[model samples]
Target: MRTEISADKVKGDFLEKVEELSGQSIWACYQCGCCSSGCPVAEEMDLLPNQVIRYVQLGLEEELLSSKTIWLCASCFQCFSRCPRGIDISKIMDALRQMAMEGGVDRFGPVEISPSELAKAPQQVLVTVVRKLSA
Candidate 1:
């Protein structure tokens, strides 16, 4: 289970976008894995919270957007509070969700909600579903 990370492919603008949109510097993350350690759901994530920051730092926009990790985030803010660098992992998750939405839902993983079910769901629930499932 080896993963190859190409720093050469890191997009400057993508990194900038994460910082600019989220108002949090991705470079601030030192990859100490504190965020991941604090994440209660990290065990269920395809990529840990710390890994998400690494993806942003490396400008791996496509990889970040395609990952199920961002969608699995509980947004409990536990990781954010525990981050030694004070990085807002939750905000980064939101930024990733926004990017996914901008790319269109198809760029994300498969979703199995029927139109009728979605229509019948509450507004906030629908919004959360779309936000999380969009990626």
Candidate 2:
């Protein structure tokens, strides 16, 4: 993806909002790759944990917010456990998910699925999806 980064973008409100919501210093991450290395679902993510943090740091709001990595996070805390900076990546992911949902970016909902598919879906999976994806 070709993104144009500027000083204004790096100092934008989105970065402040993310820091406020997640309560983590976005600049604290040194990109040691520990978080990504320990992430069990890293392969499935569009952006790894460290890459997500870098995106936030660079104020790539559109790309970061639209990423599937935020929603795909399992909140297993594996990334946090491995982070040398003690940054909880799961919390950041949660904040990103919240921001995305608030912005009306629905990843999953009744409209996206067929009735037959919804009917065949596991009850637990449906419940989890509703809890996570619903605004």
Candidate 3:
């Protein structure tokens, strides 16, 4: 497939870092579909695991960097373990997640809560439990 991104589109070491961290060069993927078949989240992904690998191979930076599938990955390592080529599919997803975050796409979804909001739960129950334990 044709890609919108040229070699000049990527800046600095982003793609290099992705390849390093994922432990498999994009060129090594033969599109055998083993990774996609074993992926638990494959059915839910906007692009299948094999497709994502191909996009990366084509240097489709924008598409790979902004995909919802990157965040949807639960990091279960199933895909990584099952890949016949031994490509680290989970790490590829992780790298994609980092790229997406750096690009400000917010992979957690449209209305994800901020860290501050998640920490504001009531503390009274904890206090009561502590007091009871102390008695």
lDDT of each structure?
0.80, 0.88, 0.69
lDDT of 2: 0.88
Residue 6, candidate 2: C-alpha displacement in angstroms: 0.9
Ranking by lDDT: 2, 1, 3
Distance from true location, Cα of 132 in model 3, Å: 36
Give the 10-residue window scoring lowest on summed lDDT in candidate 3: 126-135
Highest-scoring model, TM-score: 2
Error of 1 at 68 (Å): 0.5
Instruction: Report the error of model 3 at residue 21, Å.
Output: 3.4
Over 4 Å off, model 1: 1-8, 106-135
Residue 89 accuracy (lDDT) in model 3: 80
Candidate 3 per-residue C-alpha lDDT over 1-135 given as tens digits, one digit per residue, 9 for 90 to 100: 345765665443555777986777776789999888888888889889889888776667777776667766776788778877878887787777766666665534313444664477456634533322221
**What would you estimate as the lDDT of candidate 3?**
0.69
Give me the runs in candidate 3 sitting further than 4 Å from their true place. 1-15, 109-135
Residues 19-77 of candidate 1: C-alpha lDDT, one tens digit per residue: 87789988888889988887899888988898898878777878888888877886899
Cand. 1 Cα-lDDT: 0.80
